[model samples]
Target: MAQTVSFMAVGRFEVREQTAANAGVHMTSTSPHREPIRVGVVGLSASGGWAATAHVPALAGLDGYELRALSASSAESARAAGEKYAVPLAFASAEELARSEEVDLVVVTVKVPHHLELIRPALEAGKMVFSEWPLGADLAQAEELADLAHRRGVLTAVGLQARSAPPLRYLRDLVAEGYVGRVLSTSMLGSGWIGGATYDDNYAYVLDITSGATLLSIPFGHSVDALTMVLGEFRAVSALIENLRPEVTNITSGEVAAKSAEDQIAVTGVLESGAVAAMHFRGGTSRATAFHWEINGTEGDLVVKADRAQWWYGGTQLYGARGEEGALTELPVPARYQRSLKQWTERSADPACSVAHEYALLRDQITGGLAPDTHGVPDFRHAVRLHGLLDRIRGAARVGRKVTLTEQGS
Candidate 1:
């Protein structure tokens, strides 16, 4: 029988066969042969937020990983987070955690501004790293990190979680199979009113380009990453953005805040594959507008309605519809994984569901050592390319012109 326990200690979670004492702290075997990877998570504060909710639970639930250590900026918070999440070891700082021999994989889920600070230390320690996306605050940062990893022959996986979404996978396969016919154009509409929690310190850094919370960096990143994967690399893009959410509650503190990061972003671009895409990220309304996207092609049209992805510690559900002629065809995630996916999905889990899938997929990749085509884990190569595109978008917004991507010979 599956054991169920619900708690509000750190983040809300109800796991079967685990307690608050073991929730994110321990791992059990799904198969007798599955060897668990001992992982130490640094940045348990807001930056390590996903590690608590997604990585910690995801790793614990699976037969693959054992959560050994939890770290914060200080030993006190680290101990607090470790106790709260049930991690056995708590470190005062990330540097100390990285050096521990028990930590095979050092997962760095830190703030964008502190990404380099934490990740560099882990890489230098010769541990595999699974950091969050935009990989770095900018192209230069990304390049620097990638260069270090390349030099050391260390394994790295960025938080580009959408790559593992079944719906996204379906879309990519459909396009390759010519189900969507010749893709002609793609448009994505994703926006909703920002809650008071939307303006917390976790996101303030984004407002400052140096902090890495640029519109072209995050919200724009979520949809664009999925769009590009299903479609192809972009060639040129023209865009603009607006700061609509002037005020928000501290996402972490629950206090109202002054926000300047653009609430909406406007963009149009053509992929090297010749498919055109127009995307919008908005956050000024009272109503929440879920992810709404459509692709027009010669064979047929594919449309994705609101919220195709979901994440819950209990598990994850991918929900999306494939359409041709404006009618629904197939739904993959919510239907397929509905049994394993948890019910709390409609809330915090949705934003990071795609990312969660990538972790499971990449965990399998590293098991085989570094090799090409391992569970479709993308290397620094793709991350560098993504950073370049982001640079173009940021630069375009500054220059008020279309930024073109450099096309390299295949």
Candidate 2:
């Protein structure tokens, strides 16, 4: 027989079996389980936000991570957030949270501008850090952070969760196993979110290229990253970036703001695998404007597409067909590709499902010392590499000539 017992304290949900021994309770060992990784999330809010919607729920659903602490700009906000999320500790500053012995890992989800400030202290404290995409304001910042982590000897992870996606994982395997035969070329087209007509005040920062949160870095970067993951890295490339909508009216303020970020992105490159690649991501969304990426090979072709522009939000439909197969047939992503936690599937529209997968991979890496793989977790070095590629693309666009990526440090 099993008895139900609950505690109202810090680490309350941590389950332990106990047996009656005299007047005291003795913990009985039914099975051995590793303690959850204590995570401290900086910039987590009391009200609903990105970390709240995705990270919080994802962490809660997993057994390998404990939502330990939350940090906000002020002590009041931190306390409120802690209360709202039921987190044990709340700190008003990143340094405090980073230095706390209660936290085994520091997760930096703040904006790009504050990333360096929030993450640097955590790295200095020798605590593992997980920063969101666009790891820094630019490539140089990303490299600096990577170097810092290297010097500190602390592990780091990035929010390039698209790499952990199950669909892309299966797609890569299918191509490698000769389902797509010898890959010839690949192409992708998607919306940039701000590419359409109206604009929101909340998304105003994306219009500024300096913010590093523009269409190019988020959607285009993730999409291209997924593409290259299935295919291979780029060798030489030519890129063209243009800003058609120079001025946009904020829906909330009804005030026009200068949009400097490029809304139209066109890049053609050769993959290290000898396959040619072409990608064009436009701004804004429409009924017919869907995110589509196709891979053409000698034996057959494969297509990965989504109704919405974002890659991580919903599971993209994958289709493939060989010579005898009449039309493109649906290639279902196998159950093996799915997350161990089924709760993630319930929120298909949220990107946190894939984020959860990344978190799981990181947990394993931290607790079990698992090595990082192509389809598993990505670190700051990976972010630096992607930043270098984005920089090379920008350089190619600026020079109006093809640029080789050999010189970029790995």
Candidate 3:
């Protein structure tokens, strides 16, 4: 049975007090929104990318953020982005934008290799920073940035937006409320980035294990994180990783690339709750299903399935069955679980929904003067913890043995 915890809702903000020890884990809190925060987005390109499509739309739809400045690789690109986005200030370099008095929050949307370089300046300036996931090139870099943020006492956030995803959030509550009885075991199977036969030119580097944005690190990472958000952390895990697709054709470049990245990944683990868990991610979509997940408990079961691998993008369906309650039937998310954000409608992408939630949580934290861990916002330390987990999973695969996880944090 799950422990009962009391909570209070203030508008869309939920309030609960958590000790400071859990620095990077999600807690709860409530506070009214304050003045709009001035944001300078690094890599907000006019040419369109993740930042342009997701962050731009997400921020534009939010109330507490003012998209003030943009930074690009070149002065011309910077000026062009500013004109296109209607941002008044633009800089050719991240340092200039981070140091500007006009930028209260620095949003780093650059490539994985550039995160450390782009985010360091903002951290040094004691400005709030939000960087995309795979927070650093590797665990070491991620820890370095996290340590800097901690030392500087500046608020920080990461792109592990899976926690803020609406359906995932609802799923968490359902599990905590014992909707599935006692979670005996959980499993997930999904199509991964490499699952496709062809790849984009931009993702060519992702095919290399050295890039840090591998099949195991991104889609797999995000999926696992989202799973843990609802189920709990793993106590130990055994994993197998293989590079079945050693050679992949780049659809855009019309070239065959030697892919060192693993395309077939599998993991079996024990959750903190003592429930068994297993996950398998493959490079291509299945002929029958794109994604499927099941949670079996002593008295009931819950299932979440999606047509695409990125369910966090607001495209998942829920089903449940209790005792002999016929077959698993669809469970509609209640209106109460829906946040009051006007932009948090059915049309929002998974990234946009999660980003908007993170913004709201940060706005409340800054306005309420709450601690970092006191909300569900995933921060740098959270990224470090995830990095450690990934490392352990890799180790398990390396040694062909189940490894124990003792590292702490979210």
Which regions in candidate 3 have their CA more than 4 angstroms from the true location?
1-33, 348-351, 369-374
Model 2, C-alpha of 224: deviation from truth (Å): 1.4
- Model 1 bad stretches (over 4 Å): 1-34, 45-48, 192-203, 244-260, 284-288, 307-326, 333-355, 369-375, 408-410
**How many residue pairs of model 1 clash at the backbone?**
5
* Model 2: CA > 4 A from native: 1-33, 345-347, 369-375, 407-410
Give the whole-model CA lDDT for all candidates, comma-separated. 0.63, 0.78, 0.79
Backbone clash pairs for candidate 3 read 194-283, 195-283, 195-284, 313-350
Clashing pairs in 1: 161-354, 161-355, 196-249, 206-213, 318-333
The candidate that achieves the highest lDDT relative to the unseen native structure? 3
Q: Which pairs clash inside model 2?
A: 195-283, 195-284, 196-284
State how far residue 328 of model 2 sits from its true place (Å): 1.5
Q: Which 10-residue window of candidate 1 scores lowest in summed lDDT?
A: 8-17
Candidate 3 per-residue lDDT, tens place, 75-135, comes to: 9999999999999999999999988988888999988877888999999887878898889
Per TM-score, the best of the predicted structures is 3
TM-score of each: 0.77, 0.89, 0.90
Residue 22 CA displacement from its true place in model 1, Å: 43
lDDT string, candidate 1, 121-238, tens digits: 8888777777877788778888899898767656667776766665666667667788667889988876533322366564555545467756567656756767877787788988
The per-candidate count of clashes, in order, stands at: 5, 3, 4
